[model samples]
Target: MEPNATTNENLNLYEKAENYTKTSLELLKLKTVCSVADVVSTLTSKIAVGVVVAFFTLFLNIGISLWVGKELGEYYYGFFIMALFYLIVAIVIHKTHHKLIKTPIGNTIISSILKEKQN
Candidate 1:
């Protein structure tokens, strides 16, 4: 083979490599965008659900408190009782933060991201 032909072949190979690199970069960018969108969507939905549940819980607590107040003939005692209940619950959740909330949430996000990658 002539030296000039060999040089031409090298240049052609370089061009193909550059093109491949650009294509790979674009694919990576697209994947990153998709991953972000998926995670955001999951979090948004979770937040919406959480808000709805929180509202339901709040109203339920208020209703129960009012009923208890009527029974006890004291309007404020029921509120205190509800507050105490919530305090205990908060403490328990704080103590078991990792097992009850953190780990599961982490695993869920990771799994969802991985699942998206697989697709």
Candidate 2:
């Protein structure tokens, strides 16, 4: 082939490669945006549920405290007992922080991303 022909072929090949790269990059960006959106949605729902559950637990605790006080005939002692129970729970949660909180959260995020990819 002529030198000019070879140069033209090389240019065509380079153009193809550049087009391929652009397409790949666009696909990557789309996937990343989708993944981020999924994560944000999941977190939003989880946070909402957490807030609702927190309110429920608060009222439940208060009710139990009042009941305990009524049974024992000392109003504030029930509250103290409820507080002690919470303290113990807090300590247990603190000790198992990774097992109870971190791992599950990480797994949830990872699974959400992976699930998005699968779909």
By TM-score, who's the top model here? 1
lDDT of each: 0.92, 0.94
Give the per-residue lDDT digits (tens) of candidate 1, residues 1-119.
69999999999999999999999999989988888899999899989999999999999999999988888999788898999999999999999999999999999989877886688
Candidate with maximal lDDT: 2
Which pairs of residues have clashing backbones in candidate 1? none
TM-score of each: 0.94, 0.90
Clashes of each: 0, 0
Q: What is the lDDT of residue 92 in candidate 1?
A: 100
TM-score quality measure for candidate 1: 0.94
Model 2 Cα lDDT, one tens digit per residue, 51-73: 99999999999999999998999
Off by over 4 Å in 2: 116-119
